[model samples]
Target chain A: MTDLRKSDRLIKLGLLMIAFSAISALFVITLFIFEQGGPIMFKYGLKSFIFGQDWYPSEKIFGLWPMIVGSLMVTLGALIIGVPLGLATAIFLAEFSSRRLARILKPVIELLAGIPSVVYGFLGLMFLIPFIRENLGGPGLSVLAASIILGIMILPTVISISLDSIRAVPDCYREGSIALGATRWQTVRMVVLPAARSGILAAIILGMGRAIGETMAVIMVAGNAAEIPSSILQPVRTLTSNIALEMGYAAGEHRQALFATGVILFVIIMVLNTIANLTASRQGKR
Target chain B: MKETAIEVRNLNHFYNRHQSLKNINLEVYRHEILAIIGPAKSGKSTFLTCLNRMSDLIPGARVEGQILIDGQDIYRPEVDVVALRRKFGMVFATPIPLPMSIYENVVYGVRLAGKNNRPELDRLVEDSLEKAGLWNEVKDRLRISALKLSGGQQQRLCLARILALKPEYILLDEPTSGLDPISTMKIEDSLRRLKQNYTIILVTNNTKQAARVADRTAFFLMGELVEVAETEIIFTRPTDKRTEAYLEGKFG
Candidate 1:
C-alpha cells in the first residue's frame, strides 16, 4: 500500500511538470512580445501609434487605425455571414434532421475545419475574388472576400458547438412545450433556444475570435493596402496581414511595430475567449 | 351511466417492432379521476402519452389504434396536431419547468397562442397557480426562476402550467413520484377539485394512492391491461389473479 501511494505521488508530480510546460511557454511568449513591443508604444507616443494614419516604416511612423478598422469590419462582416447560417444549420441538425441525415452532414461540416486555411484562401482568391472584381466592380481581393472565406472557415466551430448546446437542452422541456400544444417550431423558438441561449452565445463568441485571429487566409484574400477602407468592396489591410506582409526585412522600429500589432491581436483574442468562457459557465449554472 | 370523454379501441403501440402497448381498450369518463396502476414496463405511461399523441414524437414509434376524443378520431392527418395536443394537458414523471420565471412558465402555452395581453396574462397566471394549490407559496415571487423552487413546488408549477392551457383532459404519468407525501396530498386535493372541470388519467406505482383518490382503477401487466373496475371493487375483490397478486404485494 505504501509503495502504491508513493507511485501515485510520483506520477502526479510527473504530470504536473508536463502541464507547467505549456503555461510557462505562454508566459515566456507574452513577456517577450511585451518586452519587444511595449517600448515602441511609449517611444512613439501610445496615442499616435494607435491612431496615426501614415504607415511609412522607414519614416518610423506607424498608425494602426486602418488595420484596427479593417479587423473590425472583416470580423463584423464574417459574423453577419456566419451566425445565421451556422445557427440554422445547427438547429436543422439537432431538432429537425433524421439521424442518418445528421450523421452524414455533421461529419462533412466538421471536415471543413480540417482543410488547410491556405487552401481556403486559394479558393477565395481563385473564385470569390475574381467574381467580385468582375461583377461588383472592385479589386478582387477586398474585405468582402476575406469575410466570406473566414465565415466559411468558422462554420464548423460555430455549428458543432451550437449543435452540442441545442442538444444539451433536456428533452423534457421539449416534451412539456409540445404537450402544451406548441408546434415544433414554436417549441424550438420559445423553449429550446432560451435554454440553450448562453451556450449558443459562447459558440458565436468563439467563432468571432476565430474570424478576427485568422492571419493566413485574411492576408491572402484581403488586398493588403494599409489604409482605412471607404467601403467593404475596397481593399483593406488587417492588423494580422500588416504584420505578416512587412515582417520579412523589417529592421528597427518596423519590427517592433509588427510585434505591437501582435500584442493587440493577442489582447483582443484573450478578451473574446474570456467572454466565451464566462457565457459557457453561465450555461452550467442552470 | 357516466358519459365517456375518451374512447380507445384496438390500441396497439410499437417502438421499432417491439410492441409496448397491446390491444388496449379503455373508456375514460367525463369529470372522473382514473388511476392506472401497474409495475414497471407495464405500458401505463405509454397509455397516457398515446392518449395525447405525445408518443408520436418518438422516432420509430408506430401506432395501430383508434383514440377518439369527444367522438372525433385524433389520428386523422388533417386534425391539427397542435390543437389536439392542447386538448390533453400532460405532466410527466419528473416535473419539467421550462427555464423561465414562474409566471412565464405558467403562461408559456398561452403566449404561444399569441395572447400577449399583460393584465389578462397576470390574471391567468394567478388563476392557474391557485387551481394547482401553488398560489400562496409562489404568489410573492412570480418573477423568480421556476428552477429555484423545491421539487414539489416545481411539480405544482408544472401542473399550473398545464392548467393555464385550459385542456380538456389532464394526463399525469406518476407526477408525484419524485415529490414528498405532503406535496402528494396537496396535488391529490387539487385533483379532486379539478375533476369538476376536467377529466384526469393518472398512472402510478403506488396502489394505495389509487385506492385513496381514483374513482376507477386499472391494472396493466406486461403491455396488457388485466382489469379495470371501480376503485373499491378493484382493490377488494379483483377478478383477475394478476391484479390480486399485484395489489397483495405477492408479485409486481
Candidate 2:
C-alpha cells in the first residue's frame, strides 16, 4: 500500500510539473512580448502608436489604427456570415436529424476543422476571388474575401460546440414541453435554446477568437493594403496580416511594433476566452 | 353512470422488438383520481405516456391500441399528436423546471399555443400557481429563477406549468418519489383538490401514496395489470391473489 502511495505521489508531482510548464510558457511569452513591445509604445506615445493611421517602417512611422479597424471589420464580417449559418446547421443536427443521419453528418461537419487553414485560403484565392471580381466588382482580394474564408474556417468551431451544448440539454426539458402540446420546433425555440443559451454564447465567443487569431488564411486573402478600408470591396490589412507580411524584413523599432500587434491580439483573445469561461462556468452552476 | 374521460382497449406497446406493454385495457372516469401501482419495469409509465402520445418522441417506440379521448381515436394515423398531447398534460417523477422565471415557467405552455395577451397571461399564471398550491411562496418572487426554488417548490412549479395548459387529464409518473414527506403531503393535498376539476392518472411505486389519494387503484406486474378495483377494496380485500401478495409485501 505504501509503495503504491509513493508511486502515486511521484506521478502527481510529474503531472503537476507538466501542467505548470504550459502555464509558465504562456507567462514567459506574454512577458517577452510586453517587454519588447512596451518601449516602442512609450517612445512613440501610446495614443499615437495605436491611433495614428499611417504605416511607413522605412520612415519610422508606425500607426496601427488602420490594422485595428481592419481586424475589427474582418472579424465582425466573419461573425455576421458564420453565426447564423453555423447555429442553424447545429440546430438541424442536434434536434431534427435522425440518428443515422446525424452519425454521418456530424463527423463530416467536424472534419472541416481538420482541413488545413491554408487550403481554405487557397480555395478562396482560386475560386472565390475571381467569382467576386466578376460579380461583385472588387479587386478579388479584399475584406470580403477574407471574411468569407474566415467565416468558413470558424464554422467547425461554432457548429460542433453549439451542437454539443444543444445536445447536453436534458431530454426531460423537451419531454415536458412536448407533453404540454408544444411542437418540436416550438420546444426547441423555447426550452432547449434558452437552456443552452450560455453554452451557445460561449461557442460563438470561442469562434470569434478563432476568426481574429487566424493568420495564414487572412494574410493570403486580405490583400495586405496598410490602409483603412472604406467598403468590403476595398483591400485592408489586419493586425495579424501586418505582422506576418512584414516580420521577415523588419528590424529595430519595426520589429517591436510587430510584437506590439501580438500583444494586442493576445489581450483580445484573453478577454474573449475569459468571457467564454465565465459563460461556461455559469452554465455548469445551473 | 360516470362519464368516461379516457378509454383504452387492447393497448400494446413495443420498443423495437421488445414489448413494453401487453393488452392494457382500462377506463378513466371524468374528474376521478386513478392510481396505478406497480414495481419496476411494470409498464405503468409507458401506459401513461401512450395516452398523450408522448411515446412518439422515443425512437423505435411503437404503439398498437385503441385509445379514445372524448370519443376520438388517439392512435389514428391522421390524428394531430400536438393537439392530443395538450389534452393530457404530464408530470414526470423528476421535476423539470424550464430555465426561466417562475412566472415564465407557468405561462410557457400558453405562450407556445400563441396566446400572448399580457393580462390573460398574468391571470393564467396566478390561477395555475394557486391550483398547484405554490402561489403564496412564489407570488412575490415571480421574476426569480425557478431553479432558485427548493426541490419541492420546483416540482409544484412543474405542476403549475401543466395546470396553465388547462388540460382535461393530468398524468403523473411517481411525482412524489423524489420529494420529502412534507412536500409529498403538499402534492397529495393539491392532487385531491385538483380531481374536482380534471381527471388524473397517477403511477406510483408507493402503495401508501396510492391509498391516500387514489379513488381507484390498479395493480400491474411484468407488463400485465393484475387487478383494478376501488382504492379501499384493493388495499383491504383485493380480488386477485397477486394483488393480495403484492399488498402483503410477498413479492413484486
Candidate 3:
C-alpha cells in the first residue's frame, strides 16, 4: 500500500511538472516578445507606431496602420464569407439533416481542417486567383484571394464548434417550444439559437483568431504589398505576413519592429480569447 | 349530462417495436380535472404526450389509434399539426424555463403565435402568471432570469408559460414530482381553479395528489388502464386488485 501511494504521488508530480512546463513556455514566449518589442514602442510613441501607415524599416519609420487595416479587412472578409455558410451548415447538421446524412457529411467537413494550409493556398493560387483576376480586374494575388482562402480555412472551426453548441441545447427546450405551437424553424430561431448564442459567438471569435493569425496561406495568396489597398481588388500586407516576410532580412531596430508586430498580434489574440471566455462563462452561469 | 371533450378509441402507441400504450379507451369530460395514476413506465406520460401530439417529435415513435378531440380525429394526415399542438398546453416532469427572463418565459408562447403587441403581451403575462398563482411572488422582478427562481417557482413559471398560450387542455406529466409539499399544494390550488376554464389531464406518481385535486381518477397498470371512475370511488372502493394493491402499499 505504501509503495502504491508513493508511485501515485510520483505520477502526480510528473504530470504537474509537464503541465507547468507547457504553461512556462507560454510565459517565456510572451516575455521574450514584449522584451524585444517594448523598447521600440517606448521610443517611437505608441500612437505613431500603431497608426503610422509608412513602414520603411531602414529609414527608421515604422507605422503599422496598413498591416492593421490589412489584418482587419481580411478577417472581416473571411467572416462575411464564413459565418453564414458555417452557421447554416451547423444548423443543418445538428437539427435538420437525417442522422445518416449528417454521419456521412460530418467527417468530410472535418477533413477540410486536416488539409495543410499550403494546399489551400495552392488551390487559391491555381484557380481562385486566376478567376478573380479574369473577372474582378486585379492581380491574381490580392486581398480577395487571401480572404477566400482564410474563409475556407476557418469553416471547420466555425461549423464544428457551432454544431456542438447547438446540439448541446436541451431537448426539453425544443419540446417546450414545439408544444407551444412553434414550428421547427421558430423553435430553432427563438430558443435553440439564443441558448447557444454565447457558444456560437465564441466559435466566431476563435475562427476570427485563426484567420488573423494564419501566415502561410496569407503569405502565399496575399501580394504582400506593404501599402494600404484602396480597393478590395488591390494587394495588401497583413501583420503575420509582414513578420514572416521581412524577419529573414531584418536587422537592428527593424527586427525589433517585427517583434513588436508579434506583440500586437499576441495582444489582439489575447483580447479575443478573453472575450470568448467571458461570453462562454456568462452562458454557463445562465 | 357532461360533454365529452376528448375521446380515445383503441389507442396503441409504440416506440420502434416497443409497445408503450395498449388499446387505451377513455373519455374526458369538458372542464374537468382527470388524474391518471400509474407506476413508472406505465404509459401514463405516453398518454399525455399523445394528446398534444408531442409524440410526433420522437423519431421512430408510432401511434396506431385514433384520438378525437371535439369530435375530430387528430391523427389524420393533412391536419394542421402546429395548430393541433397549440390546442393543449403540456408541462413536463422537470421544469424548463427557456433560459430567459420570467416575463419572456411567460410571453414566449403568445409571441410565437404572433401576438407581439406590447400592452397585450403585458396583460397576457400578468393574467397567466396570476392564473398560475405566481404573479404576486414574481411581479416585482419580471426581468429576472427564471433560472434564478427556486425549483417550485420555476415549475409555476412553466405553468404560467402554458397558461399564456390559452390552451384548451392542460396536460401535466408529474409536474410537481420535484417540488416541496407547499409548492405542490399551490399548484394543486391553481389546478382546482384552472379546471373551470380548461380541461386538465394530470398524470401523477402521487396518488394523494390525484385524490386532492382530481375530479375523476384513472388507474393504469403496465400498459393497460385497469380502472377509471370518480375520484371518491377509485379511492374508497377500487374495483381493480392492482389499484388496491398499489394504493395499499402492497406493491407498485
DockQ of each: 0.78, 0.72, 0.71
Q: Per-residue CA lDDT of candidate 3, range A1-286, in tens?
A: 9999999999999999999999999999999999999999989999999999899998999999999899989999999999889999999999999989999999999999999998998899899999999999989788898899999999999999999999999999999889888999999999999999988997899899999999999998889899999898999899999999999999999999999999988887788789778877887676
* Candidate 2 lDDT, B185-250, residue by residue in tens: 999999999999999999999999999999999999988888898999999999899899988898
Q: Pick the candidate with the highest DockQ.
A: 1
Clashes of 2: 0
Task: Count backbone overlaps in model 3.
Answer: 0
Pairs of colliding residues, candidate 1: none
Per residue, candidate 1 scores C-alpha lDDT tens digits across B132-212 of 999999989999999999999999999999999999999999989999999999999999999999999999999989998
| Top candidate (lDDT) | 3
Interface RMSD values for all candidates = 1.5, 1.6, 1.3
Error of 1 at B53 (Å): 0.6
Q: What is the TM-score of chain B alone in each candidate?
A: 0.99, 0.98, 0.99
Docking class of 1: medium
Please give, for residues B12-61, the per-residue lDDT of candidate 3 as tens digits: 99999999999999999999999999899999999998898899889999
TM-score of each: 0.97, 0.95, 0.95
Error of 1 at B123 (Å): 0.5
Backbone clash pairs for candidate 3 read none
Task: Provide the overall lDDT of each model, using Cα atoms, as 2-decimal numbers.
Answer: 0.92, 0.91, 0.93
User: For model 2, what is the error of residue B123's alpha carbon versus the real structure, in angstroms, after optimal superposition?
Assistant: 2.1
If both were scored by DockQ, which would come out higher, candidate 1 or candidate 3? Answer: 1
Q: What's the residue-level lDDT of A163 in candidate 3?
A: 94
